[model samples]
Target: MQRIDRFTRRSLLKSLGVGAGLLPMLEVEYAQAQVPAPRCAFIFCWPNGMLSTSAATGWPAPSATAAGITFKAFQASLEPLRDDLLLLDGIDYRFLRDSRAPENTGHACNPGMLTGALFKAPGTGTSSIVAGGASIDQYIGSSLVNLGYRGLPSLNLGVFVKSTGRLSWRAAGDAVIPATDPYRVFDEIFKGVPASGGTGTPTPDPTVTRNRSMKKSILDTVRKDLTRFNLRVGTEDRKRIEAHLSSIRALELELDRQAMPPVVVGSKPVLPPGVNTAISENFESTTNMMIDIAVAAMAADVTRVVVLQLGDQGNANVILSTLGYKPAGQVGNTGNFNGHHAIAHRNAADKDKVDTWFQS
Candidate 1:
C-alpha cells in the first residue's frame, strides 16, 4: 500500500470529486484507497431514544434480504442515503439497565448509551453523575492517537450546552464538553491551514507568528510565577495552581506547533462570514452551522473522530414548532407541546415524529 500522508489523501479524495456532503457514499471507497486513507468515526447522538416498538413506528422493519430494509414513512428523511445507512437493532447496555434505579432509568441511560457502562453512583450529598468509563468515540480516538495520527485526538461538537447530558467521556468522571460555537471550532481546527492560491511552502504570516510567540512568552512567564508561588500555598491551592500551570504549558506547546508550516493539500475552505458562532435562539440554524464545521474539519483531516451530541435527554428547550408539527398538547387541551422533552413523554406518536425529525 502507498503510504500517503493526511494532505495527500485529502487531495486525492477532492480530485475524485469527493465533498463533505458525499462522505457517507465514499466511506467504503476511502477504506479501499491505495493510499493510507484517513479513517473517521462519527457518533451522532440524540436523546429520548428512537421509536423502535415495531415497523409501524418507523423503525426499519426486519428483512430477510439486504434490499428489504427500507427507510419509509416517518423515516423518509433518510431516503437519500438509505443505501449507506446501517441499522442495528436488539442492542442494549445491560450494565446500565442493571445498575440504575428504575426511577432514574430514562436520564441515566443517556451517559451509558454510548459508553456501554453503568453510571457511577454519586457520593452522599452529591447530585453529580458520570459515566463509568470512556465512551466508544473517545476509546477509538485514543487508539488512533496511539497509532500516530496527528492533530486533535477528537472533536466534540454540539448545539447543546455543557450542562446537557453528555455522550462522550474521556474517562470515568471526565465528560468531554463540546464546543457549541462553530466559528471557534473552525478556528481551533483550521486556523493554521494554508490559504488558497498559496505556494507549496506557504510562508507563515508574520502577525500570526508574532502573536503565537507573545502568547508562548506570556505563558512561560506565568508558569515560572506559578512554580515560585506554589511553595507558599497550601496543598489544595498548590494543586490548583499546578493544574493551571499545566494548562498554560499545553497552550504554549500548541502555539509552538501552530507556528510551524501547515501541510497543505489543496485550496483551504473559505470561512463562512457573518456566522452566528454563539449559541443561537434558532436551534436548526445552530445545528446546521455546527454540522458544517464538523464536516469541514473531517475534510481537512483535522480530526478522525467526531462525536456530535444532538440534544440532551429531557431537555425542554428545543422548539420544533418551525418544522410544521402541531404543537404538543396536554391530554385534552390543545396547545403547542411545552417542549421537546414533554412531547417525547406524551405518547409513541409524538416520539416517532420527533425521532424522525432528528433523523432527517
Candidate 2:
C-alpha cells in the first residue's frame, strides 16, 4: 500500500512537469494576458461660450461661392487635429432659449446644456434650480454599466463648479458632485491595489497556527522557483520580465508617495492642507490635475466615461491676464468687460479672442 501511494504521488508530480517550479512562469503569462482596453468616452465642458464667426478668426464658414467650408486664422491651432475635429454649427438648445425664465438665460442653459431638458427652477430663485432629466453622459454611462462594464460607470470631475452648476445629472433633481481634490481622486482610483513594498498582509500575531506555517512554506518555495526560472531565461525574456517587475515597483513607489502626508514648510504645508481645498486653486493647475486623474482612471479601467466641467457658466472666473490679454476696455462702442463672463457678452472680437485661447 505504501509503495503504491509513493508511485501515485511521483506520477502526479511528473505529470505537472516542473511541478511548483512552473508557478513563476504561469504568473508572468497570466500578467501578460491582454485585457482588452476599455472603450472610453470623455466629455469636456467649458464655460461662457465659443466664438462663431466666418471672418479672420479660425471659425469655419459655409462657403458662398464654393461647395465646402472655409476655415479662418483663429482655427490654425486646430490644423493638426482637423481630421479628428467635428464642427457642429447652428445647433441651438431650444429648451434653454424657450425656457420659462427669459431673463436668466445663461443660468438656465448651464444645467440644461447636456441634459437637453429645461431647468427645474425653484419657486424662489436660480440657486435651487436643477436639470429636468439625466444628462447624456450619465445615460451613456448607465447603459455601459448595463452592458457589463466591470469598473466604475463614470467619473464626474469639475473645476470651479458648484453642485448647482454640475453638467452631469443622474435624475431630475440629482446632481452628481465632483471630486475637487486631485489627491483624493488619485487615492480613490488606486484604493484597492497593494502599495509598493507593503506586505499587504494583516498581522498574524493573533491567528498564527499550523495553516499559517504551511502558507509561509508555500510562499518560500514559490520565491525559490521564481529565482531558478529567472536564471534559466534568455536575455530578451529576462529584460521583458525585469521591465514588468520595474513597472510594478514604480507603481508601488507612486502609491507610497501619494499616501505620504504633506511636508510642512515653515508655517504652512507645501501642499493644500485641507481635503476640501483643491490641490491647486490656480485654474490652469486645477484643470491639468483633473485631466491627469481622468486619463489615469481611464487607462486603469477604473471608469469608462468621464465628464470634465472646466468652469460653471455663471461663475467661470478665468483670469484673462494669464493668457496675455489685458482686461477688455471699450473697443469702439463696447463697454468695459472686466471678467470672463463680461468679456463673453462683449463684441465678437473679444469673444473670438477668448474662444481662440480656449481652443488652443
Number of the top-ranking candidate, with TM-score as the measure: 1
Measured on C-alpha atoms, candidate 1 has an lDDT of 0.59
TM-score of 1: 0.68
| Alpha-carbon TM-score of each model against the true structure | 0.68, 0.58
Off by over 4 Å in 2: 1-37, 54-58, 62-85, 97-103, 191-281, 325-337, 348-350
Residue 220 miss distance in model 1 (angstroms): 8.4
RMSD after CA superposition, every candidate: 9.3, 22.9
What TM-score would candidate 2 get against the native? 0.58
Over 74-107, each residue of candidate 1 has an lDDT whose tens digit, in order, gives 6566666555654544444455456443335566
lDDT of 2 by residue, 41-142 (tens): 777777766655525444465443332544566556655544444443444556655555555666557677666565555575665666776776666666
Q: Which candidate is the best by lDDT?
A: 1
Candidate 1: Cα lDDT at 122: 53
